[model samples]
Structure formats: C-alpha cells, structure tokens
Target: MKFFQIRALAASVLLAGGLAAAHAQPAQPARTAVRGTIDQVSPTSVEVTARNGTKSTIALPADVRVAAVSIAKLTDIKPDSYVGTAAVPQADGTLKALEVHVFAASLRGMGEGFRPWEGADGKKGSMTNGTVGSVVTTSGTTMKVKYKEGEKTVVVPPDVPVVYLEPGDATLMKVGAPALIFAQKGDGGALKALNVIIGKDGTIPPM
Candidate 1:
C-alpha cells in the first residue's frame, strides 16, 4: 500500500509538471502578408514607404522583377493621390522595391462619366418654359446651366436630381424621353417636379 501511494503521487507530480510546461509554452505568432508600396529604387536596395508614412529599406535580389504603374492607367484616382509604399523581398530575404502601392488611386479623368453624379434619382419631374443655357461650371451642389434664347441668354438653376445620365456620356437619351428636371419660375419660385417628365433625347413629344 505504501509503494502504491508513492507511485500515485509521483505520477500526479509528473502530470502537473507536464501541464505547467504546456501552459507556459509561447504562442505562435500571427502571420501577415508583406505588403507595401515602393518609394525609391537603387541598384542594391529599395526604399518603401508604408501607409502610415514609415520608410523601410529593402535589399534587392537578382531574380526579382521591378515594374512601374502607368500614369494613364490610374485614371479613376485623382492626380497626386497617395499610394502606399512597399519594399520587395528576394528569395534570400533581400529587399528590392524602392516603392510599392499599399493603396493607389486611379489616374485623373480615366473613369470620368463612368460614375454617376450626385442627385441622379430616377424620379419623374417637369420644367415649365425653362430657358436653355451652357453650363458655366458647378459649384458646391448647384450647377449653372445656361442657354441663349432670342437676344437674351437665360440662366436657369436646375435642381440636379439623381443622374439618369452621367455628364459627357450619352446613353439612349432622346427628346421627350421621360426625364425629371428642376425649374425656377420667373418670380423666383422654386419646386422639384415630381410627376412631369421631359424628353432628354431632344425631340419634344406632342403636347
């Protein structure tokens, strides 16, 4: 009986020791992808700037390919938009890329008119005796569409509704096509057309 008790206590001690060792073991570190944009390039090493603007220098490898993104291809993004930088790594763990794109914007004007402008809600509306005008430009949320009728160029403020058609991109728009346009009365009365529709394609439908 004495020997059996001793053996049991020893087994318990060993089990406890094993449990303690297992609990004390270090956890495996999380794996993350090495991604960043290049900032500068050199023969031996490249410098990459991170999204947070931190710069890292990486060594170059013989088998790595270096490439640059075309300015024309980046059309969707505005000019001078910041792209994240990164350093390329070689097989031997050597850094190569001087700059990389952690984040990049498309070049300006490449995707123009592809994205609809604000206020393009597909609601039906109307305008009464609205004058025509050239769009001088847009400011804030208002667009100044100007047109010349007879001797006077009438400036009309059209409330831009949800864009049924984007600017510079004409898609199947015809005169008398159902469209909603904002209009102002001569007495400065302003209201949104909720039901009356107009032909955007150019030919006015018979009244």
Candidate 2:
C-alpha cells in the first residue's frame, strides 16, 4: 500500500509540472490591418493618410520589404506613390495588415512659381530669373525653389502650370523655348511675369 501511494503521488507531481509548463507559454499576438497613404517615409517609419483624411504613422520592422503594386487597378500609382496598407510579419512568420487602405494623388504641378515677396526686413522683394537648385516643397499649391545662389529659398505660388514631361519631351523642352514664370509678393500675392522667357532647361535637382 505504501509503495502504490508513493507512485501515485509521483505521477500527480509530473502531471502538474506539465500543466504549469503549458500555461507558462506566451499567447499568440492578434493580427491587425491598417490603411493609409504614404505621408512621410523613412528608414524606420512610414506616415500614411487614411480614407477619413486622418494621418496614421507606423514603425517599420528591420525585415520590412517594400514593393509596388503591379496590377492594372493600381496603375495610377507612380514611383514614390502613396500606398495604403502593408503586411507586417510576426515572429512566427505570419502576416497581417488592418483593413485600412491609404490613397494619395501626386500634387507635383499644383503650385509652381508662387513666391513670398515680403522679406524678414518687412520689405517686399522679388526673386529674379535664376537656375533652380532644388524643390523644397512638392505638395499642394505651394512649391519652394532654391536658387543657385543658395542665399535664399524662394516660395513659388500656384499660378504657372506645373507639367510633367516625358523623357523625350523633357529633353525637347530644355532645348526648345523658354518657359515663362510669374513672380508674386507675400502669401497668395499678385502674380506678374518676372521673366519674359526663362530657358526651358531650368530643372531642379533631385531632392
């Protein structure tokens, strides 16, 4: 009787240890989906704009992969195009993204040549014809162009039409005619043709 009782106690202890080990295991994380536009993207974070016009920022894992949509329905996307949702991988290799999809249209040409004439000295001034060094802003009706002098950055307003040229046409425009650009003073100021013709070759370097 003593031997049998000792054996039963040992078996019970073994079963309890097994149950404790199982309970100590971590629970699986739930999958989620998120949708939004690419507001800002960096090596570690991606900013997106949602359908409700709200912005959502997400952190990127070290193993994150970036790819463009190749389907016809997604052809409207351009390089650096805003994307909605992206799958995030779990430690166990499962993928998940919330149901949200982000959307953003390129506003490349919406604002091309508007400038703020008022300077820090409270005097109104104008930016003259010069080489475009870089684009400071590429969204909405405002674009800031940095000139070669680099002394000041000029604010371009939304008067002159911004056109995206094909590679062939871009070359032609650079060689053919001069493009006219209007100058303005203050924010949303009056626009007047500053240069009758600026060489069409005026292109801002890549940012």
Candidate 3:
C-alpha cells in the first residue's frame, strides 16, 4: 500500500479500538434509598436497621449531606408546591398516601415523576414527585399532583406523616431517630452513604 493509504488505515484501526474499549466499560450502579432507623453512627460509618429488621452498615463519607425532615401539616402543601409522596393503590383505584415530603423551593423539580417504590409496609408502593395542582379538604385531605408525564390524586389521612426537608448537621444522627438514608452499593456489595434525611422529636421520615 502507498504511504498515505497505510497512514489512513492505521488511524481507522486506532479509532475502532477506542470505540470498542468505550463500549466495553461497565455502567455505574444506580443509588437506592434505604429507609431505616440509625442504629449507630460514627465519624466514618453508620449502622441502620431496616423496617424489615435487616441490618445494614453504610460508609459515611466526609462530605455526606444531612437534612432534617421535620414534621409538617397537610395544609402546608399548597397549590403549585412541589412534593413527593409514597402511596399505595386503594380499592377504588385512588392512591392512599403513606407519607408525604414537601420539597423546598430549591428542589422543586427534582425527581418529577411517578414510579414504583417501597413503602414502610415493605410492599408495593408508588412514589409521586410533582407539583400540587389542587388540594381538597373534607373528611380528609386530598391532593391532585401533576408531573411531567401525568398526575395522581392522593388521599392523605390526618394521621399520616407529613414532613419537609431543612438544613441539618451531623448532630441529627443520634440513635433511635427514624432516618431515611440514601446509599449506593458498589460492585463488591459494600454500601456507601450518599445523603440522609432524618426526623426529629419522634417524627419519622415519610419519604
């Protein structure tokens, strides 16, 4: 082959190899939410007891973010407010909320959709994160939440936990408080904490 032809062929071969290598790289694991109580907390790690009684120890990174999910009233969720709720389908196809977390203005559009989630009961649940379109209060509170894809009408009982996220620190990691820790499992099965939402004064994180 001519000199120029040989050079071109070599460049193409190198490009193909690079593309193959890129395709072979494994995708990173997605983070999953862990709803449990903090059993122990150290400077480096945290031990949690899942609602089902299983124990998990997740590494706490130096920069791990902590937020307090404090108790709120159902009336706090107003029109156009962003919120997320975990609910289960009821007999009449309406959703019954297990817990609701009102997001701050900065987090308005985060996780805006409805997806399958696990409730406190450890059974099939759906999480809806969206803007509140309307709120009706009669015997109980009902909210019509709208998201990018769709909307859902959720029935919120008076006794269900309603909470909102606020700035928190490591001091909220005290034992016996209900916490929802978000952690990612590595390929080797070790879990590392990402963010944590803890409840204060006997409150439990609803989301």
Candidate 4:
C-alpha cells in the first residue's frame, strides 16, 4: 500500500510553558483536524461521520491537504528518534508520561518545543518534543529527551500507547475511507478542507 503524510511544516512557536491558554494567541497558518469516517465525497464537498456518530458536510477546495496513515510500534523507538509526549508533572518535578507520539524524520522541526497540554480531565499537563537520547528499561521504561533549550525525563509505563506517522499522499481519497480532515470555516459560514488524512485497506486511522 502507498503512504501519504501530513507534515506540519510551519515555523516553530516556542511558548513560555506547555501548550497552554497563556500562549493562546491564534496562529497564522492555522490547521484544523476532523477525525471521522467518510460517508460521501465529491469534487466540491465531503460528508463525514465523526467518532461520536455526528455527521457533517464540508466543502472540499481544489487545494485540499491529503495524507495517509499507517501503523507503528513501541519497539520502533530508539536513539535519535524525534518524539513528543503529553506528560503529567510528578510531585518530585519529573514527568509522568500520559501519551507519546513519534514523528517521522521529515518533521524534525515541527512543534519543536514544550508547552502545557490540556488533559482529558480538564487539567492542563505538559507537551514536549525532542530527539530521544536514550531509553532506560528498569521498572517500566524511561525516555530521556533533549530539545533546543533543555531536556525532559518521560516515564513510559507498561501500558502506555506508542505510535508513529508515515509519509502519505492524496490518492487515497475515497468513500468509506477513514480520515482526519483538517479544515477551517470560510466567510460564508462553511467548513473548508485544509488537510484530509486517510487510512488504507480497511484500516481505521488510530491517530
């Protein structure tokens, strides 16, 4: 199967803290992601069924962004791999890992900074992106990551999910395909596509 990747290639925005409300200024090249199943598709529009069972119809522009998704593994992590993780700060000031995402080498500079991350529980945590210097396996696992300004220790528990992205293109656009559509609203009160991330061969996009 062929692959297509959505590369966030904008300039890095270094915040004072984790991706937080404090750094809530709007970005210039803003990108939006809509994760759902494709229900309908045409040259000008698309209909999607969201994960929660809601459906929405969006305009598909000529220059819509399209990418492909693939599966990855935890053992694929190694030294020099650029990765990011949402971490909860421990009482001892270290970081307890919540979720980890590995990036392809093409994304070396994408979001290459740390900031406060909004947790599922309404509390904000931390998000750090850096190259993995080493992985320590003792009780569970530990990833020592180094960024431009500093370093962080990420504690990878036994059951924490780990995955990576792959390079994908726009050819995978089809009905019944699982996709993450990144789009924005136009002046006419309609959602327009920016990025359409698709999965191949009966595979649902897990990212």
Candidates 2 and 4 compared: the better one by TM-score is: 4
Better of 1 and 3 by lDDT: 3
Deviation from native of the Cα of residue 80 in model 4, angstroms: 0.6
Model 3 clashing residue pairs (backbone):
none
Clashes of each: 41, 14, 0, 13
How do the residues 159-202 of candidate 2 rate in per-residue lDDT, one tens digit apiece?
22222222121222222222222222223332221111112233
Question: By TM-score, who's the top model here?
Answer: 3
Candidate 2 residue-wise lDDT at 57: 47
Please list the residue runs of candidate 2 whose C-alpha ends up more than 4 Å from where it truly belongs after superposition: 1-24, 72-207
lDDT scores for all predictions? 0.24, 0.27, 0.77, 0.69
The C-alpha RMSD of each candidate to the native structure, in angstroms, is 33.6, 30.8, 15.7, 6.8
TM-score of each: 0.19, 0.24, 0.75, 0.71
Candidate 1 residue-wise lDDT, 1-207, digit = tens = 000000000001122235546564443232111123444555544454433455544444443322222111122212233222112234653322221121122322221211111111221222111121222323311111112222122122222111111222122222222222221122223222111212233321111
lDDT of 3 by residue, 1-207 (tens): 100000000001112235547564454565666767889999999899987798999899999988887667888989999998888899988899877889888778977898877544446678888999999998778999999998999999987777786768899998887787878778788899888878777566656
- Runs of candidate 3 with Cα error greater than 4 angstroms are 1-33, 50-54, 90-93
User: Please, what are the lDDT tens digits per residue for candidate 4 over residues 31-55?
Assistant: 4456678888888888998766988
Q: For candidate 2, give the lDDT of residue 65.
A: 28
Best by lDDT: 3
The CA-based lDDT of model 2 is what? 0.27
Q: Report the CA-based lDDT of candidate 4 relative to the real structure.
A: 0.69
